[model samples]
Target: MVLFQEGLRIKMKDLQNTLEDYEQVKLSCDHTAEYIKVQSNNTEKQIKEDFEKLHQFLRDEEAARISALWKEEGQKSRMMKEKIEQMVREISSLSDSIRVVKEKMGADDVSLLQNYKSTLERAQCALQNPERVSGALINVAKHLGNLKFRVWEKM
Candidate 1:
């Protein structure tokens, strides 16, 4: 019976030590969990801030592109208008020459005939020589190639 009591006392001590060790382990686990949670929160906050900065940069870039497009469009429009006006003036001058030639059809004026021939040549040359205007254009294929890479690098 005395040997059995000593064994029981040893088992109780072992149980007490186990309980204390378990509490210490649990405390350590809780601390680690809290630390992970704080780190996760910080990482989340940083990602959100980076995302906001990227969003703002994209917005500003879009605005700048739109503004530049508008300015280019206005410039092209003005150029087209000027070209049309010049064409109208040329047509008017040609029409006047045609009328004068028709009036001089029966007249035996050598100087008038030469003038009409010169005017006719001028009109033919103007018709043959057309002005070509190449307007502004966006290259989507080229831009898309570097777009993803540029954004990723920025991040």
Candidate 2:
């Protein structure tokens, strides 16, 4: 009976260790997702700023009919496009890394990564189309306001 109790204790300790390992893996995944979200936000902001600046430059009368202005604007636009492409590549690579890590943790955790993946895709899409993004944001805000009103009425 003494030896049997000792075996049971060892098994319990092993199970505890496994649970701790899984928890650590989960935490790491969560951290990675947060980092990706932050990076996406920063990239989106940069892209939107660049696009607005380019649009403003194109609209400026002073920039009109000036060859140098055209060249400068072209260069700036190219640079912004390159940066956007690089950000997209980095986002894709990070997603691949996340998938690998998830697989290492366990195939069953794939669903857990879906929200992260969806958010990343949304960020990328918004960066690609600012006008559409702005419209979508407006719609979302309107919906949120309606929901809040409904909740307040219920209360």
Highest TM-score model number: 1
lDDT of 2 by residue, 26-123 (tens): 99999999999999999999999998876675555233434544565576667667767887886787677667655544534566466556545543
The clash count of every prediction, one per candidate, is 0, 0
- List lDDT for all candidates, in order: 0.75, 0.64
Give the top-scoring candidate (lDDT). Answer: 1
TM for every model, in the order presented, reads 0.67, 0.38
Q: List the residue pairs that clash in candidate 1.
A: none
TM-score of 2: 0.38
Query: What is the Cα-based lDDT of residue 31 in candidate 2?
Result: 100
Candidate 1 lDDT, tens digit per residue, 1-155? Answer: 99999999999999999999999999999999999999999999999999999899888766765676677667777888888898888778778767765666656678657677764565453454556666534434544557657656756
